[model samples]
Target: MLLPLVWMISASLMPLSEVIKVPPVWFAPDKYSLANYMEVWSRVGFSRYFFNSAFVAVTITILQLLTSAMAGFAFARYDFPGRNVIFLIILATMMIPFQVIMIPLFIMMARLKLVNTIWGLIVPSMVTAFGVFLMRQFMMGVPRPLLEAARIDGASEPYIFARIMLPLCKPALAALGIFAFLGSWDNFLWPLIIINSQKLWTLPIAMSRFTEQYIAQTHLQMAGASIMFVPILVVFLA
Candidate 1:
């Protein structure tokens, strides 16, 4: 399991000759350097792709957190007309594949004039069915009596949510944030479909192009892959 990651990191640090060698050298302390990283970062305009990915991913994660938590809280704590039915509908969306909706989603983005823009990648992904479902399931475990006690003290819904509910939901929020960030960071198909401009390309798209341009430079390709891997590792650790 760790071997692939180990190889990626090791290969990223190696020169072209060592990377392409048969029975690949697993350790070459003397040959390893940051030259490939430098080239990828500078020559390949990786900085732009990195920024695009980070910005879009963070934006989506934040929006998903807020939207999911709020919706989940309402579903768990409040009762209204068709509440169960509505919740069921939301859960049903999770069963539908993204491939089934991508075309319509793209058309909607096109109609909104969002295609080829950063918001095009962001707006559609700001909310997710899985996020809502996860938050709702977690929030369901939160004791209702606690909320009722707060209300007895004249706490408003907003106050209870902000001051009490949110605090209690840190674990759920962390889990949701990890999923949202990782999904957005690694997202490829949606970005590929909507974005045509070079400047707007995310790391995944840019990395795809980088591989094509440097198909022979396995070291550089590994460096690009390593760059893509870091944020995911950070999010996991976080």
Candidate 2:
């Protein structure tokens, strides 16, 4: 993994001409330049892809977190008719693979006129079953007496959740945020299926096209790969 990261960065810094050299040059022969990056940026609209990815990832993470946390809270803290059955049904959906429903989901999106739109990508992912499960499990560990005490003190459910339970779930929130962001950032197949327009393409789609456009040009491919992962690598490291 680290090898790829180092090789990509080094190859990207090298001029495109040197990238295809048989000896596989480690860096620019003499003067390393950022021309490859600039070229890749101009060709792929790096900034636009970055913004679209950031928007989708951040929005999905936030919305999923809120929905998951709230749903988890309800499942853990309250008892209602068929609550367990409903929770089990939701968990069962997690067992059903995306492949099983991909075609139907596509048809639904087409019917909704969401195909080729940002919402097409985002709406489907804003509430993941895994996210709900993660939050539910985490919330279950929270003490019931504490919530009861808060209720006895006249705190509303929303107040108790926001002020008390959320503060305690920071680690879970962080983990989910990272997972959700990374998932959205690296997603490829769904976007490929949904979007036909070049202007709305995300980083992964752009990278796929980059490879097709420059097939066997390993250096350019590496540069494109580098462009794709640099931001994510920084985020992971941080």
Indicate which candidate wins on TM-score: 1
Per-residue lDDT of candidate 2, residues 1-238 (tens digit): 5776777888777776776778877766584777777777776577788777778877888888888889988888889999999999999998898889889999999999999999999989988878888988998899889999999999998999999999999988888888888888899889899998887898899887778878866766776788778767766776
Give the lDDT of residue 154 in candidate 2. 100
Question: Top lDDT: which candidate number?
Answer: 1
Compared with the true structure, model 2 gives a TM-score of 0.93
Worst 10 residues of 2 by lDDT: 24-33
Scored by CA lDDT, what does every candidate get?
A: 0.95, 0.84
TM-score against native, each model: 0.98, 0.93
lDDT of 2 at 236: 78
Candidate 1, residues 104-131: lDDT per residue as tens digits? 9999999999999999999999899889
Model 1: residue 87 alpha-carbon error in angstroms? 0.6
Error of 2 at 224 (Å): 2.2
